[model samples]
Target: MNKNNLIYIFIICFTLISCGKNRIKLISENSNLILPKDFKILQNETQSTGIADFEINIMLQFDENNFQKIIHQVDSLILVDPNWKSSNNEYYYENFTNQSEPSNIKIYKHNKTLKFVFNHI
Candidate 1:
């Protein structure tokens, strides 16, 4: 093959491998989860939400339907790759707490489509 052809082949192969080399696939397929009610993710778990402590209701259970396993699995992967580096995909987890909710909620968001929701309790 010509030198130019060889160079092009190498570049294409390199791009395909490099494209996914750093990516952390949190899930084979993305699943989205929505927070119940008007509740939104709290940036800080410690911050007071201005709601009555007892009034908060945030009890969540992890199940196959909710796909909470992906979040937990990613948590373990983060230890291996502390950066959890990804080229196209995003992995995010946040501690959520509200004034009325007695339980703590952990929200795991992967890219735009994959989301896992579960309570800390």
Candidate 2:
């Protein structure tokens, strides 16, 4: 099950998060969502275009069943924000009252990891 690769990813996420340089964490071992401590992020993917809007996408390399677990974890957080809505298994969230914080997260099975795509504004 490529336990080493799984562990490797786990370590990397924690290191990045601890230093406050990146946002990644384990929702569960089988899942590979790379969520932050508070399930929030500023700029996940860094591609500057005009206004420098950022969209985050982090890959963890897990499978489908595990991906489901990741999805559940995310849902828990989404419930906190009443406006959250699920569309085709994808979630779109925005906290209009608090600095306009928003999160758009998606999950998919990748080569060996479940890819976690995050878009927070």
Candidate 3:
């Protein structure tokens, strides 16, 4: 084979390998929540408080925008277990009467981390 032919073959092989390694992960269109790094997704009856019969818990760290987006769409969010049993169907939002002081909205500082807890009940 000539020098030019060898170069072309090498370029084609490199392109194929690079493209194969750059495969895109297809995420569900309806999924708006993003899971955090090293987070655990728990979906077991034993993990429930017995009041709900079943539960699905996702522990993760989120940014301000992500957190706000979640809070805004909390009503529409659904919690699904490994068996595909949803526990968020009967979920109801209680009144914010317990909040004595007005809920304050403040800007989070750089590198600040916040924990979000969501119960199935």
Candidate 4:
């Protein structure tokens, strides 16, 4: 192949690879909140109209320990029941205001997947 063809292939490959899922660390000042090993950002969007708004949705596949850890941390931060536990792939959902910011946080978990959505307007 020619030099120009190789350049085109490289550009295409780079674009494709960059489009893959983004990873992030779930950070918080709350000491009880343990960071998961891997969390993939499924969707991240921002818009500016009459008002500015943004949303981040991340998902993680976890085991029992992770589920309990998150549950306890969220409970302490949001004043919910920390004793709540999951079994038989039950679904859990909660929406609460962000204590440290002007945003809303929503957590949904089912089976082994946990999803967190944060929205600001």
Task: Report per-prediction Cα RMSD to one decimal.
Answer: 17.6, 10.6, 16.4, 6.5
CA deviation > 4 Å runs, candidate 2:
1-44, 51-61, 96-102, 108-121
lDDT of each: 0.37, 0.46, 0.33, 0.49
Quote the lDDT for 77 in model 4. 51
**C-alpha lDDT (0 to 100) for residue 119 of candidate 1:** 26
Candidate 4 Cα RMSD after full superposition onto the native fold (Å): 6.5
lDDT of 3 at 15: 83
Model 1 stretches with alpha carbons more than 4 Å out: 1-3, 25-68, 71-121
- lDDT by residue (1-121, candidate 1, tens digit) is 9999999999999976664322212112222223222222222122234453211222233344344454555656556644243333455533333322223223334422333332222
| TM-score of each model, paired residue for residue | 0.23, 0.38, 0.23, 0.41
Best by TM-score: 4
lDDT of 3 by residue, 1-121 (tens): 9999999999999986664333111011113333333322221112454665432222233466665554444334434312111222222222222342111111123322222222234
Q: Pairs clashing in candidate 3? A: none
Task: Name model 3 segments beyond 4 Å from true.
Answer: 24-121
Q: So what's the TM-score on candidate 4? A: 0.41
Worst 10 residues of 2 by lDDT: 25-34
Compose the digit string of candidate 4's lDDT tens values, residues 61-121. Answer: 6577776777666666545544233344443343343542232233455545555444554
- Residue 56 deviation, candidate 3, in Å? 32
lDDT of 3 at 8: 100
Which candidate number would show the highest lDDT if scored against the true structure? 4
Model 1: lDDT of residue 92:
51
